[model samples]
Target: MSKGEETKTRILQQAAELFNQQGYAGASISDIMRVTGLQKGGIYNHFQSKDELAIQAFDYAIASISKHYRIAIRSKRHAIERLQALIAVFGSFAENPPIAGGCPLLNTAVESDDAHPALRERSQQAMNSWLNLIRRVIQTGIEKAEVQNNINPDEVATIIVATLEGAMMMSQLYNDTVYMQRAVNHLNHYIENNLKINGTS
Candidate 1:
């Protein structure tokens, strides 16, 4: 990458963590300067405005999260196993998030809702992508007869995402991983018993 391009990327990476850790409104231009080591003029040279930078950084953060998930499920063959892997991914988020702040989806959703239109839309898009991915896995499982044919992919995906997000919030709030751990354990068991392996049922 060219020098300017490399600098722009570095800004995005640093700003992503800053925004995730501090809400969009909570993070100021001075904060960005502090994080990126770039002056106001240097920052504006790349991003048109703070709003523009915020949007791009959010996209960057979500992309980072998606990349880690792709790595987590890359080797799994079974759909149930893939879903279980997702649970483990969320568990890891509590300990070591793709970004420093925690789950970008949860953080952005909570902070942006009814507040920032641009960032809110970005969070919704990222969530839709996540939900669709989960739904596809469940649908594929049904097709492969690894899970019951009657299983509702939409419903299952919602349950999985909601459970993990809620658990992560509680964990982060209490400054404890046990809540996330409980969520992971419950979801894993839910897959084992409720989803039931093809022949196990």
Candidate 2:
């Protein structure tokens, strides 16, 4: 990459970490400059304003998570294994978080709900992407005869998304990973028993 490209990437990287740690409202452009050792002019040369930076940072965060998921789920051939891969991803939050802050999707959704429309839209897009992925997985399971034909992909997708996000919030609130694990475990059982064809109860 060119020197300018490198500097711009550095700024985005630092900004994403700061936004994740301090939140969009809590973290300032000055704070980002301080962390990146860039002058105000340097930042402005790349990003027009903090709002723009926050959106870019949010994108960067989502990209990071997507990259992780792509790599993590690549080897799994079975839809059930792919679904289990998601649980493993969440399970890792207890031990190793991919980002400094909690889940960016959750953080941005909650923080931007009232304050920033752009950020809120971005969060909504991220969630829809997640739900779409789950829905596709369920559809695949149905095609493979692993999941029942009558299973509602969208409904299951919503339940999984809601349950996982709620679990993450509760886990963060209590500073306990066990809450996430329990939620995921129950989700796994639900998928296995209810959705799977001839699944054992």
**Best of the candidates, lDDT:** 1
TM-scores of the candidates are 0.97, 0.93
Alpha-carbon runs more than 4 Å astray in model 2: 199-201
**C-alpha lDDT (0 to 100) for residue 191 of candidate 2:** 78
Enumerate clash totals for all models, in the order shown. Answer: 0, 0
**lDDT for each residue of candidate 1 in 1-201, tens digit (9 for 90 to 100):** 999999999999999999999989999999999999999999999999999999999999999989888998899989888998888987889988889888988999999988899999998999999999999988988888888887889999999999999998998899899999999999998888878664742
Question: How high is the CA lDDT of each candidate model?
Answer: 0.91, 0.85
Model 1: which ten-residue window has the lowest total lDDT?
192-201
Question: By TM-score, how accurate is candidate 2?
Answer: 0.93
lDDT of 2 by residue, 139-165 (tens): 988898877899999999898888888
- Model 2's lDDT to the true fold? 0.85
Model 2 clash tally? 0
| Residue-level lDDT for 6 in candidate 1 | 99
